[model samples]
Structures are given as structure tokens and as C-alpha cells.
Target: MPYTPRKAYVVGVGMTKFDKPRGERDYPELGLEASVKALIDAGLTYDQVETAAVGYCYGDSTCGQRALYQLGMTGIPIVNVNNNCSTGSSAFAFAANAIQSGQAECALALGFEKMAAGSLGSAWDDRAQPMEGTMTQLFEIEGDKEYEVDDFGPFAARIFGAAGQEYCEKYGATWDHIAAISAKNHKHSVKNPYAQFRISPSSADVAKARKITREVTLPMCSPTSDGGAAAIVCSEEFVKAHKLEDRAIELAGLGIATDSVKLYEDKSRIELAGADMSRRAAQKAYQQAGITAKDVQVIELHDCFAPNELVTYPALGLCAEGEAHKIVENGDNTYGGKWVVNPSGGLESKGHPLGATGIGMIAYMALQLRNEAGDLQVKDVKHALTHNIGLGGSCVVTVLKKAPFYKEGSHCKDRFGYDFAREERRMTQEELDKVRSKHFSDYLPPSVPESKL
Candidate 1:
């Protein structure tokens, strides 16, 4: 929360097609595709960026340097961030804060991931697990309850599934309600060209999908994905200087919160899974934006699992406490409903690459505000909210709206020389060259070549 007289705006955004991991591409190619496209979307080159924040969950130190050097060797600050699932938005927050603090008039926030196939696992094994405390808390809560642990699914399933079970217990929500959410997201992804899983399923099919746990099913989770997404954040001065008024989406409010006593003292599985963290962060963002959750028309939350999305509804103040089921049953979370949640299919259908996921949320919302989301666009969306969280844990809540000077579809034709928002097209070498730094290097080749993935 760096204070500044300047307001931050998202002037550019880009995302690669999310795919199931095939190991065909490395992080550099994925990272470069997103970075280059974002630069092109801004109608700017790499040299103009004063600083950069790059995020990824699994990579060596200096990966950001490796990723950015492909654009140029200007030697501006490049920070590498790893905040688990929320890493992408954390990088974005850092970039926005720099603009707000006047440390830089413009900054680049980039997130990329080249994840492996299957469930998320620990990269380090010899040390104490960061999630060990959560496991201890979970066991304490399940004392004498004789539930069998499924050996097949990732630990995250158990964590969120237990919390979802507790939520149902407190509020009398049937598991069908949770399965409906999965079905909705799966159906929504059908129109998203970049989604990894676009096949639609019925609520009954999702509920009957192979059980990950007694309380969790296969379609109820986000699959591991490989992709990259990025945003260009700049100060109001920069936007005016560049005549980007029409394209800029205001970074109206942002709040990041970590674990509190609620995690240890509440004894509520809902709170244990970072719902309290989500609430605190959402409240701060809402207060800053001068908008309530009731005013939100669109939302892109961290639906790493359907249960996560379910618990997050109340946590984000979208509904009253213990009443998330009403929103699901009333059809308020989909198109023609009160709010469109995850029109981009959510993590459940869209795929989740930890670092890129958060920035992807911003990319989607920014498109909505600019009226460029095409068939998936919500009607008349002026204000949007996003909630990204990680367990062990941190949460970043953001409220974004159309900038005062925003004009629908302005600069769309000039941006990337086509309607990129409506279509997910791979960038050409010509397009990449248009945004490369004037001070480009030839001594060493970029980490990734100017080619397709």
C-alpha cells in the first residue's frame, strides 16, 4: 500500500493459451510470449519500462533476469516473486506500488509458468513443509471423525474439501451446490479459446465425476497448467503522456493480507483455508475503491478448487455469512445472474499455473472493462473484483473499474494490430519486433527465440 498522488492504470495485457503440460516449451518462451504481447498491447517498447516484477512458483533464482534479458539488457530492476498460487497478482501489486509511490512512471508485471503434469507437489523435500501447520490444524479439527484419507489426490483437495464440508455443515448446503459451481465454470469455458478444458459437463456429471475424496470430485478442481499472462501498469501521468486514456483500466483498489489468529483460533475449516485472509483483503480493497461487493458485476477468483470458490463467496462479502448456497442456487454466479463469476471458466476449467493465474485474472477483468471480452463479456461491467490467495498463506484482493477517460473499444484496432481480446492469437515475429527494446542486444540470443511455442 504505497501512497502516491498518482493513480495506477493497467494499460496493456496479454495471455498465452493455457494448455495441459506437455513439456514442449520452457519458461523463457512462455514468459517472453506474454511479455512481448503486453508490450505490444501498450504500444510501447521494453526500454521504456522503468522496472519489472516477474512471478513464478517453481524456478531457480534469477529466473526473472533470464526471462527479461530476452527483451533487452537495459539493466532495470527485475524482481522474482514466488507466492504460491497468488504469485502473479503479487507481482502486479509490486509493479503498481512502484507507480503509486512515484518510484517509476511505468512498470511491467509479468507472470509465467511451465508447470509439469499432474497434481502440484513440493519442489523441496528435505526441509519442513510450509503446509505442515495447516495439516496439524486439519487433523485437530477432524479428531475422532474416522474419515479415510484418499491416497490419490493432492493434499490441497483434502484441505479445501474439508473446509467445504464444514461450510455445508454450518449452512446446510448440499454438496450438489458445490458441484453446480464446477458445472457452471466448465460450461463457461466452452467459449474461452484459451481455456485448457472447454468441455462442458452437467452438475450431475460433476457430482458423479470420479471422487478425489469422499467430499471432493475430479471436475471440482483446477488442473495443473502451463501458460503465461502479463500486464503493463503505469501512473496516471504516463497514461496521459501516451494518450492511453481510452485503454487504461483503473487499478482502483488493492489489498494483500496474510494469515492472522483467525487461522489458529477460529477452529473453522473455512477460516483455516484462508477465507479470513480473503475477507480482510477484500474489505480493504472495497473500502479503498468506494464500492461494495454488491456493486460488482464480474469476478475472477482463485477457484483452484470448487470448494475454494464456494468458501470465498462469503469471504469476499458477495453473500452473507454461511449463505453461499443461495447465490449458487439462484444462478447469481453465472451469465444472466446477479454477477458473472469466472466467465473465463475459472481455474477449474481454465487451468491453473500458479504464477500466471493471478495476472490472468487481471487480464480478464481489464478486458471486461474495455468492452473487449467478446462472447464471454458481461454486459455493462463497470466495476470488477478479483481475489487471489495462497495457503500458508497470502491473499490479494483487487477492485478495478473503467478509468474516467475510458472509451469503449478505444485503441482496439491499433493495439497489436488486431482484436487480440476477442481472439487468442499467437504473436508473430513481426509483432514481437514491434515492441522489442531499441537498445536490443545481439551478443547473446534471448532465452527464447522469436518463434511459436
Candidate 2:
């Protein structure tokens, strides 16, 4: 039997304010907040969602269910996912595949993380480490180079900084050129209400910041934070049935690429860090969407580190080969440029909550496509792109735009009794009541803001 593909649309999207990990809230509260808000924004109820894919990296198995149980034990399938930093997009891709494959009419994709403060490190010590191969290869490359191999810091900074160093060594882009990309994202973060760091920094500020590595500085890296984000993905058929014509944003094309042999061929550090995976993913997504880089007006790129963003410009075909620094120099990566990249401030400023970052990217991109992003909105955007990646390694590139039936006055103006896009608000009890299942739970968290209120 042949399986015909159907269109998947992100009809609703929501997220919690990406905040420093203060331990004030748990994963359950964060996940539920984003889920309830998403359901309400879609004008749908929990019972209506046929299945779900939830992502969290710092939790035990079924932690997803623990969070979802508050919505009611609907007995719907909830597949838990963990894919390093790309966890949220992995969940999103799961839901999109579910809809497109006709396995479910509607599904939920949710991601949240309650991370430890400071630099991220591995939790498991007994098992064979997943990143061992990449780490070993990174050290080997450094051993052969003229640079000091012992001026190290966090594992993430070292590997990514190596890639940035390579870009400069190979293409004549200086460290300041790499820093400029970080500075640009910091500037963009000011308009994002959900960003963790709203303060802007100049390129010099980035260049001179406390060095994490020779090629990386403090401000150039994403922070460990606590947050959650979610989206409701459904088929076009379901949209018509639910009278959601005015708001649905089509997931026109989606491509997921995993590690190829290039990841460890003793080759470029850029490929070792999986930038080539992003390139391949973008290629597949663009082919599916029937569009080129020229057609995309806005982007929510996975700038996990400043160097990655610069490498990604060429990977995603945003600029000529090794000319990513040119994108920064020409002012083409921000508003009024050729493409407004990382208008959500990107992972660098927006705060990377492991599992939540990818989904947060989707939520922000949805706001832009709906024209409800307010201060951060890109003008006349038709196509928006989101790129999320994880090391050891996978990358998901998604292309989205307004649905054919989309109109100017979307339900966002009144959905959830306010603009879910422009106004960042937690779900009130009244609002939660509108989306939760008729069959419910009394699992109370005394620490949640809404619950405390």
C-alpha cells in the first residue's frame, strides 16, 4: 500500500519566557504552560489532540507523561524524545510526520528543560560517551595545528570555536567578523520578549569578552536556561474541518539530516561540527518547498554559538562559499537586509534550554509568518526558515509560510483573549480551562506563577 503525503501546518505555537535556571519551577510547570497555551491558541482542546511527541533531555523516561498527565490521562500516545540540543525539533518533526503520513489528524510537539546553571556537561559517566568520537577527533586536529591545544574550556566552545578558527583560516574572515554575527543577534534580542538576555552588545564587545576559547568569547555562546515551547501540528484536512482557515501556517517543507561519513573523515572542523548536515538538510527542505534561498524573508537559525551561525550561512546557502563573513559585513543578516536571520535573537541571546530551543524557534517563526511578532516582525514576510541541529549529530531544516486560506485578520487577535504572539502571558486558570480535557487532574504545583496567583 502506498502512503500519500498530506500537508502539515503549525496552527498554534507558544512558549514560556526563556529564563535563567533558578529552580523556581519544574519541568512539569514549564511544559504544561506551553502546551495549554498552544492548545488554546489553536482553538483546540487536549482531547482533540490524537497523539503527542514531547522532548526533554534532563529527565528520566516518561517525564513527558508526568507533565502531560495534568491535562488529563487521555490515553493518547505520547512518545518521549531526546536528541541532544535538537530535541524540540525532533519532537516537531515527529508530529509533522505523523500528520503527513496520515497516522494522526492532529498531534502535539512539546519541549522543555530545567537545566543546571553554568556550563553544560554530561550526566552519565559509566556508559560509552556519545560524543567521544567527535571529542577525540577535535583533540587530534588541534594536536596537528600550530595553536595551543591546552587553552581549553567547555567542550562545546572548543569544538565550535575550532570551526570558527577554520572558517577564518580558510576564508580570510577574522575573529571580529565572526563576533559581528553574535553582536547582531544580541541586538535583535531586544525586541524578543521571551529572550533571556535582552541587552545588546557590539562586535567589539563580543571580540573582547572573557575568552572561552581563542576563537570564542563569553557572549558568543548560548546559555544554559530553563524554558518550554510547543506547537500544534495538524493536517490541512483537519484545518478545514475545524474552521482554522484564517490562521494555519503550512509546514511546506521539512528535512532532517543525520551524520554522514563527513562527520569524522578527518576533514574540516566545520563538517566535524555538523554544518554539512545543515547544508544537506537545507537542500532537501528547499527542494521539497519548491523555493530557493532568495524566497525566504525571515529565519530563526540555530546560532548555538556565533561560529556555527557564520558556518551555517554558507551551509544553508545564504551566501557564497566561505563568504559568510560577507553576510555580516554587508549588514545582510538582519532586518532590511537580504534576509533577516535570527530575528528571535537566536540561541545565543534567546537562551538555549536544551530540548526547548528548537521548539522556541518554531514558535517565534510562526509569529513572524502571522504578522503578529510586533516589534520583531519582518516586513512582508512570505517564507520563513528554521534550522535546528544537535551534535553526534542531526539537523532539521523547516520551511514555512502562510497557508493558502490565510488572511490578514487572523484569530490571533482574539485567540486566548489576547495576541498570543505579541503579548507574552502565562495561561490563566480560565484560559487553561478552555483547553484542558473534560476529564482532568488536581496535580498542583505551588510554585507556578499562575497557581500561586
Tens digit per residue, CA lDDT, model 2, 1-453: 975589999988889999999998899889999998888878898988999999999999998888887787888999999999999999999989999989999999999999999998889889998898998888888788887777678988888989988999899999998889999999999988888999999999899999987778999999999999999999988998998877799998898999888888847788888888899999999998999999999998988899989988988989888889988899999988999999988999989998898888888888888888888989999999999999989899999999998766655768767766556776687877778788544543332455542
Clashing pairs in 1: none
Model 1, 399-447: lDDT tens digits are 9998898755555556766777556787777876777778756554545
Estimate the TM-score of every prediction: 0.97, 0.96
Candidates' C-alpha lDDT: 0.89, 0.88
User: Model 2's lDDT to the true fold?
Assistant: 0.88
- List residue ranges in candidate 2 displaced over 4 A: 1-3, 439-450
**What local lDDT score does residue 253 receive in model 1, on the 0 to 100 scale?**
90
